[model samples]
Target: MRIRFDNTWIADSEQAILLHEPGHYPVAYLPIEHVEEGVLLPTDRITTHRDLGATRWFTVAGPGRRGERAAWTHTDLPEHASVLAGHVAFAWRAMDGFYEEDERILGHAADNYHRVDIRSSSRHLVVRAAGTTIADTTSPVVLYESGFAPHWYVPRTDVDETALTATQTSTFCPCKGIAGYYSVAGIPDAAWFYRDAFPEAARIDDLVSFEPDKIDVFLDGKQLGVEPGQTVIAHGLDRGLQPDEIAHRDDSGLHNTEGQQ
Candidate 1:
């Protein structure tokens, strides 16, 4: 993995270690040797993780760039956590972490839990909001994700596209590329779908699924409430660059919004 911020390559390593914290996606850890010199400035801020001992933060800076509290390292670790010693990891959303010249992922780092197995289903699914049927699909794809409830993805044909107003809200799932949202009536971002799903999740391409918590989802004749692991959480650009920290450059010349070449 390679990390870049403000147009400078700060770190690159073949020894990138992927750490998957429960309830979150995986994060890459690179050996201190792989990081460029004079980039990580120790900060007073310190935090701790459950397994990784006392952690310290750093304001990472590189050629024309500065990310405040953007990097962290586990300073005092238990002996078993020796592998994490002298290694630092950056937040995926805080900085641009790429796998190669064009392989970059956003939101959270990819994890094994990212994979979703899809199977076709004949059971009828109806999505209702504001007393109107937004979708009535007899042909739905059953998506089984590791920690999420089994989702019913209704084909566009069975959905009342007119009732779905596209919203600015979008999220990136490592295995699912970018997901878009749609609003129903007054409900904001009540539905989400993978307009262009990654190859691993191609089965759900263009199929919209309603958030059980945001709207009423019915299977056959029973209502479905929020599932145990269904989260409507949104990912933010957690860290921001300081103005005058770097000159404005044309991002189009080097990277696309999707990082897909």
Candidate 2:
């Protein structure tokens, strides 16, 4: 389900309202400040759930105060008879446990995924290296899928390593929480993460290696190929499931169900 905040703490240049969730019913959770005065007609359906979940609904309208009737216009919430309003507080007084910091105010924790898509029609590169492919577009553009001098992630069994001269360089990603590096002879500038193996990126554990670059890239050729300046769609893989629940493979050879792979 989708949830949005009306009076977000974002900078003025940014939208004070944020659009969250694209699945299920979109729930609108506006900050108290975002609700215009007189428009909020509070409700009293306060009930506690066995799981400790609680919520309240409010009726909202506009023709607001002081010549301002559309305080919520900036947000995507539709104008209706009223709006829901209530603050949820949780206290796990069951066991000998209690949340002193009130994690409830943090709203629902979002399930984040690292999904990316690579595509380019200029040289049909994206389509060429669609299977078992990985590319990195960190800062300066480097094509890891292709055996280039700049050394990046390439298929473990694909790349021609005669040009590889492993260096001591390494880096990290806050998202996947993985770190590694690489280099080539006399070039001392190539880097590789893992080929079909990652202790951290179990989601993309099959990715051999990829070059991090400013612009996206694509690779094509031999065991390792080069199709620079292309985009690759990446995502996490799910764990165990029954045969009937298994996902189908796509033209890219990546198994995906719904919009996720």
Candidate 3:
């Protein structure tokens, strides 16, 4: 893993630890020794991590750019969290970019537990809105991702394109890339599609998925509905996310009942 800022490499480490706490996205913590010399300047700002204890902040400096309180480390870690004692974590939005090898990683640190599986299904899938059949297809792509409900994506050829009105709303998924929305029968953001997804999720590229709560979706003659508590609020650049950080973001889908740090 490597971090870049101000067109300079700030940190590069092959032994970085990924912390996956509840609610929040995975965060990468690298050894302080792997960070470039003089790039981290300690700051007086200090915060507390519920489990990790006292957290010290640092200003990340590179060339002519500086991110105030952009880096942090837990100074008084609990015994069980000792593995992160000598590690430092950078704020996702504060840096220019994070990379694995030559490819750039977006949204947040990739969660080892997170998985995206795409499968082609022959089951009949149908979508209706305002008493009109907007989409009907026998060949649909099923997208199963970690911690989310399965989304059925239909090819454009099977959809009634005229019934879809493009909307300005857009959301970004670290794994799937940017998702543009469409309104159906005057319903706002009732459908979404990924025109240019990340390489790993390319199978669903240019495919459309509808919101079950906003429209009537049926699969194999059975009405489809999202399970309770499965709906997620979209996270996008409007939330002050940087371009690189915009690639992946923490959505409200994950529950943070334990108040993890």
Top-TM-score structure, candidate number: 3
lDDT (10s digit) by residue, model 2, range 121-234: 222122112232223222222222222243333344444455455666544332233344445333334345533222334434323344333212354422344446443222
Error of 1 at 36 (Å): 2.0
Candidate 2: residue 254 lDDT (0-100) = 22
In model 2, the runs with Cα more than 4 Å from the true position are: 1-153, 194-200, 203-218, 221-261
Local distance difference test scores for all models: 0.74, 0.29, 0.81
Which 10-residue span in candidate 3 carries the lowest summed lDDT? 252-261
Tens digits of per-residue lDDT, candidate 3, 170-254, equal: 8778788889999998999999999877778999999999999899999999998878765334221112222334443333312
Choose 1 or 3, whichever is better by lDDT. Answer: 3
Give the TM-scores of the predictions, in the order they appear: 0.78, 0.26, 0.88
Candidate 2 C-alpha error for residue 116, in Å = 4.9
Evaluated at residue 94, the lDDT of candidate 3 is: 68
Candidate ranking under lDDT, highest first, comes to 3, 1, 2
- Specify the highest-lDDT model's number: 3
Candidate 1 lDDT, tens digit per residue, 10-106? 8888888877655555667899999999989999988877788798998988666678888889999899878888999875555654454446544
